[model samples]
Target: MAEGKVDPVHQFTIEPLFGTDHLSLAGYNIAFTNSALWMAITAFVLIVFVGGGAKQALVPGRWQMAVESFTGFVDDLLRANIGASGRAYLPYVFSLFMFILFANMLGLLPLALVGLHPFTPTSHFTVTGVLAIISFSIVLIRGFTKHGFHFFSLFVPHGTPLAMIPIIFPIELISFMVRPFSLGLRLFVAMMAGHVLLEVLSGFVISGTNAGALTFGIAALPSFLLMVGICALELLVAGIQAYVFALLTCVYLNDAENLH
Candidate 1:
C-alpha cells in the first residue's frame, strides 16, 4: 500500500471528488474528479490574477504591472506572428495563453505535501485535446466566415505545378488534419513525463532511506539532488510548453487570418 502510494503513474489518476462511482449521462460517465477540481482551481487563480490587476491607479502597482506584462507578451506574440490586424483576436488568444500558463504553473505546486492532491489538467490528453479543438474550431470558423470557400485553399499552398496538385493537396490536408492531435499530445506528454520523473525520484528517496543508511547515500542523496535540478527544469518546461502551444495556435490563426 505504501509503495502503491508512491507509484509514478499514480499521480495521473482521476478519482471522483464526490461519489464512489462515476455518474451516467447519455452513456457517458461524467464524474466530478480531482482533474476537474484542479481545473477550477486554475480558473480561480487566473481570475484573481487578472481581476486583481484591473484597478484604476495613477501609478501602477506590481500586480498590475505583472498583469500588463503578460498581456503585452501575448499581444506582442500575436502581432509578431499574425501582424497588425491580429489584435482583433487578442481576447481569445490572451485568455488561452494565461489559462494554459497558469494551469501548467499551478500543477507544479507541492500540494501533496499538505495532504492535498495536485492534478494538472493539461497533463491529460482530454483537457489539452479540448483546448486544441477550441483553437482549431476558431480557425475553421474564422477561415470560412472571412474567406468563404477560399478557406479550402488553406490546404493548397500559394503556388504549385499543375501536375503536383493531386499529391500536394492530399499531403497538406493530412498534415492539417493532424494539428489538433499533435498540439494536444505535445502538452500532455511534456507535463505527464515531468510529473512521472519527479514521482519516480521521490519513490527512490523514500525506498532508499528505508532500505539502509548505506543505500540512502548511494540512491537517496543523488536522486534528491537530481530531483531538485529536474524541478527547476520542469518549471522552465511548464512555461515553454505554454508558449509553444500558444505560438502554434497563433501560427494556425495566421493561416486563417492572413491565409499566408
Candidate 2:
C-alpha cells in the first residue's frame, strides 16, 4: 500500500502486469492485469482441482469425496429450491459456486507476507456484475423461452385486486429489476470490506511494532489478534457469500422455471 503503512484499498487496485503500450485491439488494451492474473489463477486452480476430482472411485478417495460433498451440497440446495429439474442445471450452478469459493479462499492467502499480493477479483463490481448479469440472463432467457409472455406474471402477485394492479405492478417490477445490482453489490461489498478491514488492522500491527516494545505489546498484540480473528471470520464469509450467491441464483431460476 505504502512505505511503512498499509493502504487498505491498495489490495483492490488493478494494474497491468505488463506495460500497457504493447497491445490494443478493438479500442481496448489487451494488456494482462494483476486482476486478470488472479482470475486466471483462480480458473486454472478450479480446472485442475475440480477436473481431477471428478473421477469416481469404487472406494471413493478423500479428494473425490470432498468434491462430491461440495457438489452434493449444491445438488441438495438446488433440489430443495428448484426441484427435480434443478439437476439439469447442476453443471453450471456447481461451477459458479466453486469458482467463487476458490477465488475467495485463494485471495485470503497470506502471500503478502512473502512479498506477493493476492488479489480478490470478487471485490470488484465489474467481475461480480458480469456474473450477476450472466445468471440474470439465464433466468430471463429460460423464463421467456419456457413460458413466453406468461412469464410477465412474475411481477403480478396472484389474488391481487385488479384495482391494485397499477400500484403493485410497478413496485414488484422495480424490485425484480434491482436483483442483479443487489446480487453483484452484495458480494462485491462483502469481499472488499473484509479485505480493507484486514489491511487496516495489518497497518496498525506494523505501526505499533515500529514504535517500541510498549506499543508492540499494547497496540500490535491486540491488532494482531483481531487480524487473526478476522481471518477466520473471512474464511467463513467466503463460503457463505458463495453459497448465498448460488442460492439466490437457484431462487431466481425457480421464478423462471415455475413462474410465480
Candidate 3:
C-alpha cells in the first residue's frame, strides 16, 4: 500500500471554488471565491438577526431581547462618547458591528465539507484595508463638511511653538495617514495568527494519528482542548474588534463635531 501523505499545513491553501477563470478587470482579479461567499453569508446573518428582532416590546422574547441588548449597549456607548449627535451614525455602526462579528464567527466553522468551502476575509489585507478606508473616509468627509478649511489645522496642534511647526506638522500628517494601516493590520494580524495556530495544532493531531493510533489518540485530547479554547478566544476577539472599530468611528465623529 502507498504511504499516506504526511505533509502538514495543507489546510490553509486558498483554492478556487469553481473551475471558471476568475473575473479580471484592470489590475484586480475578482473571483466567486470562498471569501466572497462567506462575506455574503455574513451579510445574510446580519439581515436575519436584525430583521427577526425588529419587533419592539416592553417585555421581549429571546431574539428580541438579544437584539435589544446589543442595540442598547451600542446606544449607551455612543451617547457616552459622541453625545446625542451619535444617533445619526448608529445604523452604520450597527451594520459594521454585526457584519464583522458574523464574519469572524463563521470563519471558525468546519469549512472543508465536500460541497462547501469556508474562508476568512478578515485574514486578507485587502478586505480589512477596504473597511479601514471606509471608516477613514467617513471621518474625513465629516471633518471637511463640519470644519471647512480649518479641518486641516488638526495636524498643526494647538500649543506647538512656531519653530517646531515644521517638525511636528509632518509627524502628525504621517500619523493621521497611517490610521487605516494600523486599523487594518491590527485585525488582520490577530485573525491570521489565531487561525494559523489552530491549523498547526490540528495538523499535528491528524498526522500523529496516522503514525501511532493509540499515542495520537491521547495527544488529540490536548489538540481538541486547545481548539475549544481558541474558539472562545476568537469569539471574544470578534466582538471586541467590532466594538473597537465602531468606537473609533464615534470618536472620529466626535472630533468632527467639535472641530478638534
Candidate 4:
C-alpha cells in the first residue's frame, strides 16, 4: 500500500491512452487520448455558447449572457483593428479564442482530474506546430486571394532602398515565418513549464515527510504559494495568448487586404 502511494512526480511514467496493438489498424492506429477528450469538451462548450447565444432574449440567462459578453468583446476588438471589414472573420476569431482559452484553463485543473493523461497534446510541439501552420496557411491564402500576386510585396517594406532588396526581403520573409513558430512555442512552453514546476514542487512535499514537520511545512509553503501565483498567471496568459493569436491574424488579414 505504501508503495502504491508513490507520488505522481516520482512515477512520471506515461502510458499511451490508445495503443496500436489495441486498435490493430495496421499503419494507422487512432487511440482515444486524454488530450482528445479535453479538446472534444472544449469544442462542445464552444458550440453550446455560440448556439445558445444565437437564440437571445431580452433577459438573457447565465450562459447566454456569458456568450454575449465574449461576442461583444471580440466584435469590439475586430472593429478597432480591422474596422467594419473584420466582421466576416468574427466567427473564426471567436472560435479560436474560445478553444485556446478553454484549453489553457482546463490544463490548470488538478492533475488527478484533467492533467493525469499520458499525452498532453498542448505540450506536444506537433500539435502546436500544426495549429501554427494552419493559421499561416489562412493568412497566406487570404492575402493572395484578396491581393493577387502583389501579396508577395509584403516581403518588401514600403521605404526599402532598391539596393537593399536582397537583404531586406529575406529578413522580412523569415520574420513572417517566425510569427507562427513564436506564437505556438510561447503557449506550449508556458503550459509545459508551469505544469512541470508544479509537479516538481508537489514531489518535494510528498517526499519530505520523513524529514521533520518543520521541513515539510517549510517545503510546502513556497510550493503552495508558487502554485497559487502560477494559477493566476495562467488565467491571464490564457486570454493574452488567445488575443495575441487573433491580433496577429488580423494583422495578416490587413496585409492581405492592403497588400502592404
Q: Indicate which candidate wins on lDDT.
A: 2
Q: Residue 119 in model 1: shift from native, Å?
A: 0.8
What is the per-residue lDDT of model 2 for residues 1-260, given as tens digits with 9 covering 90 to 100? 43557778978888888686447799887778888899999999998887778887788788888888998999999999999999988988998999999899999999978999899999999999999999999999999999999998999999999999999989998998999999999999999999999989989898898888999999999999999999999999999999999999999999999897
Arranged by TM-score, best first: 2, 1, 3, 4
- For candidate 2, the per-residue lDDT at 105 reads 96
User: Model 1's lDDT to the true fold?
Assistant: 0.90
Q: Over the stretch 1-260, how does candidate 4's per-residue lDDT look in tens digits?
A: 12223443333333345453345357675555566666777778678767988766889888788889998988887787778988888888787777777777766666666436433456655666777777778788888888777887899999999999999999999998898898788767766776677666666656554456896678766666777887788678767777777777777666665665
Clash number for each model: 0, 0, 0, 0
lDDT of each: 0.90, 0.92, 0.78, 0.71
Candidate 3: tens digits of C-alpha lDDT, residues 117-213: 4677787788888988898888899889988889888889889999999999899889988888988888887778878787766666676666786
1-260 in candidate 1: lDDT tens per residue? 34524778888998997783568799898788989888899899999999999895768899999898898999999999999988998999888888888899999998878888788999999999999999999999999999999988887887888888899999999999999999999999999999999999989898888888998999999999999999999999999999999999999999999887
Between candidates 1 and 3, name the one with more favorable lDDT: 1
In model 3, pairs of residues that clash are: none
Cα shift from native, residue 202, model 1 (Å): 1.1
lDDT of 2 at 208: 90
RMSD vs true structure, all candidates: 1.8, 1.5, 3.1, 3.3
lDDT of 1 at 165: 86
TM-score for every candidate vs. truth?
0.94, 0.95, 0.86, 0.85
**lDDT minimum window of 10 residues, candidate 4:** 1-10
In angstroms, the error of model 2 at 34 is: 0.9
Total colliding residue pairs, candidate 3: 0
Q: Quick one: best TM-score, which candidate?
A: 2
